[model samples]
Target: MNLLIAFLLTVLLMSGVWLWQRRSGRADWVDAFWAGSIGALAVFYAVFGDGAVEKRVLVALVAGTWSFRLTRHLAVRLAGHEQEDGRYQAMREHWGERAQFWLFVFFMGQALIAWLFSLPAWVVANDPSPAMNVWVILGVVVWFVSLAGESLADRQLSAFRRDPANRGKVCQVGLWRYSRHPNYFFEWLHWFSYPLIAMGAPFQWLAWLGPVLMLLFLYRVTGIPYTEKQSLKSRGDAYREYQRTTSAFIPWPPKD
Candidate 1:
């Protein structure tokens, strides 16, 4: 089946990525490849799925845009092949002598996750419905908001970090003023759009995996915990104060 082939291709490509990381000694590319692999699989499913051409094309465009934006954003950080991200550096330190082995496993896990996240796109592409419905429109709207908010958050953080005056300061500009991790929040919000888009499709329930899995990882596993730890380590009391005043995952007024 097309799904099986996509999954296999993802694993194959990520294996190559792992090898490249091993050679380059940079784990940052893992995130870029993860985003890119999902986009590739989404487009593949859209192009080859047995469904309405319009629906497939729409999903392809949407998913591709999401992937491109995220991947490019991540890629920018890798300019000059800068030092590895703190989180990954910490991971390498923790794993020590077995770092390469664990990183290989981590890269493969990302490949699997990329495929899993593509489920909504695959379902949407396979939907035979030719008409655009309220749900699809809603999904697009949510996608717009998520993309805009996330971009704003990233830009704000980048601008803050770029300023010599802001060094060692917690970013409290733009969206960051309200949410400690606005980018992560909006990234998580982006997953909801796929489920909305998948409404009424066969296997629509599978679409829920996007938002559900994203929330689980962002909240409990990969997103908040590491970022918070890194921030606390680097920013110390400033980050602690930000944490005290700002919502951890949602945009809201800061506490007094």
Candidate 2:
């Protein structure tokens, strides 16, 4: 029952967001709403699930904090009603005359994706275990490390962008110097925490979807390919050189 409602609510809200973006010409709003919807659905599950109070509450707080941080980050980028994200803009250009129709489809797809990703939170929130165990503790540790790493990556990128002298240059500062997409690596790492939290639950298998699907998306779909394409477009040879020397996903020393 709750799952059904979550799915319906996601589709409805994202449909509304589609209409809103259509009018504003800012498709990036969909990304913010998508992040928000997942968080909202995760919290909804955590609140309504019939699970141990401590576990449910912890899932709520952790998922909520992650959601809020991501949503706010995307929102800040959307401030001043700026142009659509380069990815979306490129998509629109590629889709051409049928862009609106495709965007509508894209928005609906995001709705489903958000609901799917929220399942980990649902599984964790509904864990029947009443006592803290190795899995839960491990999950929390993974979450902390991932959150800190991602935050640091974002800060490094933002600070790099802030310097006018760094304009048009690849961001090879802090974590960026190690991994070309350290933020993405950390985001993927964060998903594993959910499976860890849900380790012993009967529905624990569902939690695996978060990390598995996220990796697929990051590697083959939206994460790396688009960002790299855009970077190459903007930075040309500089980004190509960065790509040649830096690890694409994992944090590691630059290739000598």
lDDT of 2 by residue, 1-256 (tens): 9999999999999999989988999888888899999899988988899888878987887788888989998899788556787778988999999999999999999999999999999998888887778888998999999989998899889989989999899999899999999999999999998888878886999999999999999999999998998899999999989989999999999997
Worst 10 residues of 2 by lDDT: 78-87
Residue ranges of candidate 2 with Cα displaced over 4 Å = none
Cα lDDT tens digits, model 1, 33-139, are 89988999999999899879978998898889999999999888876456887678989999999999998899889888999999999998999988789999999
- lDDT against the true structure, per candidate, is 0.90, 0.90
| Predicted model with the maximum lDDT | 2
- What would the TM-scores of all predictions be? 0.97, 0.97
TM-score of 2: 0.97
Model 2 alpha-carbon miss at residue 219, Å? 0.3
Error at 252, model 2, angstroms: 0.6
lDDT of 1: 0.90
Question: For all the candidates, what are their Cα RMSDs to the real structure?
Answer: 1.2, 1.2
